[model samples]
Target: MRFVNDRDPLPLIEQLRRRYQDQRQIAYVERAGDAVVIDFTVHPAAATQGCGGANGTGCGCSGG
Candidate 1:
């Protein structure tokens, strides 16, 4: 299946939702005061820290 690139938030969000569905557990959205939070509350140990993009092995974590 081919995924069409959506520049908008909803489609992008949904795409990510499906991608991590099995491995990551729950994914949801909520209001975090002034800003919106797209919570990717994942499996704690499974998630790794993002690479600084210098070493090139970015762990695909948030900071990356």
Candidate 2:
């Protein structure tokens, strides 16, 4: 599990998902002030523990 901070993570995440497909695991994103924080987990077992969808839905973990 690692955190990647970006002003906009959608484009990058989309590209990554397309390039890696199922090889990549869960991806969670949240708004942090003016920027978006993206958390990417490569471990398949961690997928179930991840929050949010590929479309960036169901993300209440940030308290936003």
lDDT of each: 0.45, 0.59
lDDT of 1 by residue, 13-59 (tens): 66655555433443334444444444444565444533323234444
Q: In candidate 1, what residue range of length 10 has the lowest lDDT sum?
A: 1-10
TM per prediction: 0.32, 0.46
Task: Let me know the TM-score candidate 2 reaches against the reference structure.
Answer: 0.46
Superposed Cα deviation of residue 18, candidate 2 (Å) = 0.8
Error of 1 at 42 (Å): 2.2
Candidate 2, after superposition: displacement of residue 53 in Å?
Answer: 22
Question: 1-64, model 2: which lDDT tens digit per residue?
Answer: 5655656666767787765455466455677766666666565643565644345553466532
Question: Alpha carbon lDDT of residue 36, candidate 1?
Answer: 48
Pairs with backbone N, CA or C atoms under 3 Å apart (clashes), candidate 1: none
Q: Pick the candidate with the highest TM-score.
A: 2
